[model samples]
Target: MHILLVEDDHKAARLLARGLEEEGFAVTVAHTAAEASSHAHAMWRFDMAILDWMLPAKDGVALCAEWRQAQHQLPVLMLTARDAVADRIVGLNTGADDYLTKPFAFDELLARIRALLRRAVRAQHGILQVADLTLDPATRAVNRAGERLDLTPKEYAILELLMRHTGAVVTRQQLAEHVWHADLIAIDNLMDVHLKNLRRKVDPAGLPTLITTVRGRGFLLAQPEGGDA
Candidate 1:
């Protein structure tokens, strides 16, 4: 899963990002609300957001409100020093799905994150499917044509991303940011390598490409009515 972490403290941001990455999550850190907004505007789609209530400008509450207003329904976890009931209420009211106070145990934070993710998956039926390709995020399982497919972590991540958007053409930049968490322009060829491996596993006997390149744009997972050629 890819997460957007908006924290003003550089130390805290790095520590949280490192821990999240170690837990098998791709994290993008932003020190301010403006920086967070910039990242959101990019092609990547974050599964969740961790925002600090206190920020240099446009605090977390405002940012959360903005996201809700824009209909960005991703779950948000608000982190702050304020632990009062009133504060928690305000955070939730402003569209935060969860709230955590500072000085809390890292384990607890991680647990809360997992819980929120579980809730999201449940809401979406716990499985993402396109055509005959199926991915169960909870089980980390993939099946194509009723046959189980063993996929590398990278392959799974890329396929999960494409499957989430289904027929929509997912940009190379989006794949790099969410799957590889790297700069797309510098690692274009690397992205290609992963995609090639993914295609081999997904459509080994390739005639009708399940994942199709959009020429200069990017790639799209074929939809039920077949995909745009």
Candidate 2:
């Protein structure tokens, strides 16, 4: 998922952005509200926004209100040092879906973000199952035939995307754009290498290959019969 992170403190923003990226989110960092507004104006597709209440020009509350006024439905999580009930209420009134105070634990922030994403994805966030393979997006868990699978962040992202579009061919461009940000160009065979590694981990010994390559087109996730996938 792509995230818009608005934080004014350089140190704090750097730490938080690194943490989010390590957790498998594509994050765009903006140190000021104007930068955040520019990103929004560019029509960047973001799954969620993490905004700091304190800013140079426009505060997070105002930015969130502006987003609401602009009919942007992206979930917003407000971060502030103000932990008072009234302050939180004001933040919520400004259209923030969740709140996290300063000095908060990274784990808690991760949980809140995941919760908001799940809420936004209503039907899309649940446990996805296909041919004895199961994936729980909420917990980032994947299991096949009751056996747990340990997958890297990139592998997990690719698997989840394919699972989301079961039986459909997911183009290389699509995968590249989502997995690696638009600014980063996907090198030749990068996708193939990751998919190959994912296939090896997901389809164990004596199991049918679940990922099907369509030569020059893309990949499809389906149970193939009596043939190599």
Candidate 3:
């Protein structure tokens, strides 16, 4: 999973990021709210955020509130030294999904993160469809025109993301971050190859092409005009 970790303590942030990375998470550390905001609004999509309650200008509570106000559903776990009951309530009320007090155990943090992710997945559970293409997140299955399409892991990830945002453009940067967990510049050629292969299979002969490339923007998956199957 991709995580945006916002903490002002440089040493603490580095240690936490290293630990999360060791646990197989892609971590982006931000030392300030501005940096965190930039990363949050960038083309990269973060699955969750670990925010320190006491940040330099804008605190984590305020930042979390801002994200909620903007309709961003990114799960937030607030870390703070305040152990008061009222403080915890305030953090939750400010839009944090979970709270971790300072000097926390790494294992506990990891467990909470897993639990939050599980809840998120359950919330999004359902069959996804765009035009004639269908994908079952539970089964990792894909089908079109009554026939199942065999797909590689990478191809399936790309398609799932596109299907989830049907009718909207998904930028290459977003795809790379979510799928490959790498920068777009490093995986540009590799991405093109996978995209081409995916298109060939998903858009075969005698069927309307569902995936289209918007030059200088990204890829779009949508039903053709007239909505023919």
Better of 1 and 3 by TM-score: 1
Selected candidate, larger lDDT, 2 vs 3: 3
Candidate 1 stretches greater than 4 Å from native: 206-208, 223-229
Per-prediction TM-score to the true structure, in the order listed: 0.87, 0.63, 0.85
lDDT of each residue in 1-229, candidate 3, tens digit only: 7888999999999999999999988888999988888864552377889999999999999999988897888778999999999999999999999999989999999999998877776677588887788998767889988789999989998998999888999999889889888889999999999999999999999998999999999999999888953
For model 2 the TM-score comes to: 0.63
lDDT of 1 by residue, 28-137 (tens): 88999999888656524688999999999699999999988988889999999999999999999999999999988999999999999988877775788776778998
Per-prediction tally of clashes: 0, 0, 0
For residue 155, what is the lDDT in candidate 1?
A: 92
Model 2, residue 22: C-alpha shift (Å): 7.8
TM-score of 1: 0.87
lDDT for each candidate structure: 0.87, 0.86, 0.90
What shift in Å separates residue 114 of candidate 3 from its native position after superposition? 1.5
Off by over 4 Å in 2: 1-3, 8-26, 32-48, 54-59, 65-75, 81-84, 101-124, 145-150, 180-187, 201-209, 214-217, 222-229
Off by over 4 Å in 3: 146-150, 204-208, 225-229
- The weakest ten consecutive residues by lDDT in model 2 span 179-188
